[model samples]
Target: MPILGEFREFIARGNVIDLAVGVIIGAAFNDIVKSLVDQVVMPPVGLLFSGIDFARLEWVLKPDNPATKANELVAIQYGAFLNTLIKFLIVSWVVFLLVKAVNVIRRRDAQHPEATSSAPPPQEALLMEIRDLLKAQAGREEPPTRH
Candidate 1:
C-alpha cells in the first residue's frame, strides 16, 4: 500500500503530468510530420528526380528464393531512410526556430525586467517586509505601511 501511495504521488507530480502530455503531443506531431514527408514533400522531390519514389528505393542484399520455406526478400531500404532524414531535418529546423523565438522573448524580458511582472517575487516581497520590520524595531525608521 505504501508503494502504491508512493507511485500515486509520483504520478501526481506536475513534471510527470507535463512529461506525459509532451510525449502524447510529440507522438501526434511525429505522425503529422511523417504524413507531410511521405505524402506531400516526397512526391515533389520524387518528381524532381524523374518520377523516382523515395519510399520504394532499396538495395537488394539477397533476392527471394521460391524454393526456400520462407521466401522473404532481404534488402536495405535507403529511400525510406532519406525520407526519414528529411523529416528529422524539418523537425529540427522548426524546433530551432521555436527556441530562437523563445530566446528573443526572454532577452526582451531581461532588458526590461520591471515590465515583466507588476509584483516582486514572493521571496523578495517577504524579505522586504522583514527589512522594514527590522528597521522599525531598531528605531531607525517609521513602521512599515501596507500598500
Candidate 2:
C-alpha cells in the first residue's frame, strides 16, 4: 500500500507527465521525419545521382565469392550507412526547423499576447486607484494649501 501510494504521487507530478508526453510526441515526430526523408528527399537526390541506389552502396570488406554468387559474400553496408547518415541529417534539419518555428511562435505570442483583451486584475486595479488618489491628495495638500 505504501509503495503504491508513493508511485501514485510520483506519477501525478507535472514534470513526469510532461516528460512522458514529450517522449510520445518525439517518437511520432521521428516517424514523420523518416517518412519525409524516404519519400520526399531521397527520391530526388537518387534521381540526380544517375539513379544510383543509395541503400545498395557498399564496400566489399571481404573478397567477393563469385562461385556462390554475389549474394553469398559478406560486404560492409557503406551505402546503407550513407543512407542512414543522410536520414539522420534530414531528421536533425527537420527537428531544427520545428524548434525554430516554435521559437518564432513563442516570440510572436510574447509580442502580442492573446489575453490583452482582459481587464486588469482587481488587486492591480485597486493599487492603481490608490496611487492616483495619493497623487491627487499630494497636489491638493501642497505648501500653498497647507500654509
Candidate 3:
C-alpha cells in the first residue's frame, strides 16, 4: 500500500482513536484538577495554617535593596513546590482509585465467565463443524498405505 493509504489505515484503528480521545479528556481533567488545587483546596488549607499562601511562600536568599546599583530579590520558592506536591498527591490518589475500581471490575468479570462469555457465534460453530466433517471424510477415503 502507498504511504498515504497506510497512514489512513493506521489513523482509522480503534486504539488510535481511543488514544486521541484520552489525550483530549486528560487535558481537560488536568485543568479541572489544577483549578481545584489552586482555588478550592489551597484556600481552605491556607486558612488552617494561619492564612499562609503557599504560592507566595519562598526563602529569600538575597533581599531586595533600593540603594544598590544592581539589586535583585533572589529566593527559593518552596511554597509553590508544596502546592505542586499536593496537586501531584491528589492526582495520583485519584488515578490509584480509578485503577483499583477497574481492577475490581475486571476481577469480577473474570470470576464470572458466564456473565460475559466469549463463545463462538453460531456461524463460526457451523463452519468448525463442517471443517471437522471434511477432515473425517478425507481420512476415511484415503487409500491404504503399503507396508
Candidate 4:
C-alpha cells in the first residue's frame, strides 16, 4: 500500500484515535484546572492568609543590580510550585472521578449485556422459548406408577 494509505489506516485505528482525543482533552482540561487554581482558588486562599500573593512569594539568591545593568538575579518560587501542585491535585481528582464513573458504567453494561446490544434475533428468542417450554413439560410429566 502507498505511504499515505498506510498512514491513514494507522490513524483510523481505534486506539490511535482514542489516544489522540485523550491528549487533546487532557491539554484543555489542564489549562482549565491551571486557570482555576491561579485565578479562583488561590486568590481566596491568599486573601485568607493576609492577602499574600503566592506567585510573588520567592527567595532571592542574588539581588538585582541596576547600577551595572546586570540582570543576574535568581530566586526560588515555592509559591508558584505550590500553585502548580494544587492544579495537579485537582486534575488528578477530576480524572479519578471520571475513571470511577466510566468503571461504574462498564460494570452496569457488563451486568446487563442487553443494555449495550440489541435483543437476540427472533429465531434465537423463539428457540430459547421452546427450550424453556420443553423443560416445563418435562417437569410436569408424572413419574411411572409402581407395579
User: What RMSD does model 2 have?
Assistant: 9.8
Model 4 over residues 1-147: C-alpha lDDT tens digits? 999999999999999999999999989988899889999999999999999999889999988887878687899989999998898899889989999999999999999998899989999999999999999998999988999
Q: Relative to the unseen true structure, what is the C-alpha lDDT of residue 37 in candidate 1, on a scale of 0 to 100? A: 94
- The segments of candidate 1 whose C-alpha lies over 4 angstroms from its true place after superposition are 119-147
lDDT of 1 by residue, 24-131 (tens): 998998999999999999999999999999999999999999998996999999998999999999999888999999999999999999888798889999999999
Worst 10 residues of 4 by lDDT: 64-73
Residue 23, candidate 2: how far off, in angstroms? 1.6
| TM values, all candidates | 0.74, 0.62, 0.71, 0.74
Give residue 77's lDDT in candidate 3 (0 to 100).
Answer: 99
Off by over 4 Å in 3: 65-71, 117-147
lDDT of each: 0.94, 0.84, 0.94, 0.93
Which pairs of residues clash in candidate 3, taking residues 3 or more apart in a chain or in different chains? none
Candidate 3, residue 27: the lDDT equals 89
User: What digit string (tens of lDDT, one per residue) describes model 2 on residues 50-94?
Assistant: 998777877777776678745665788887787778878977887
lDDT of 2: 0.84
Q: Candidate 3's residue-wise lDDT over 79-143, tens digit each?
A: 99998898889889999999999999999999998988887999999999999999999998968
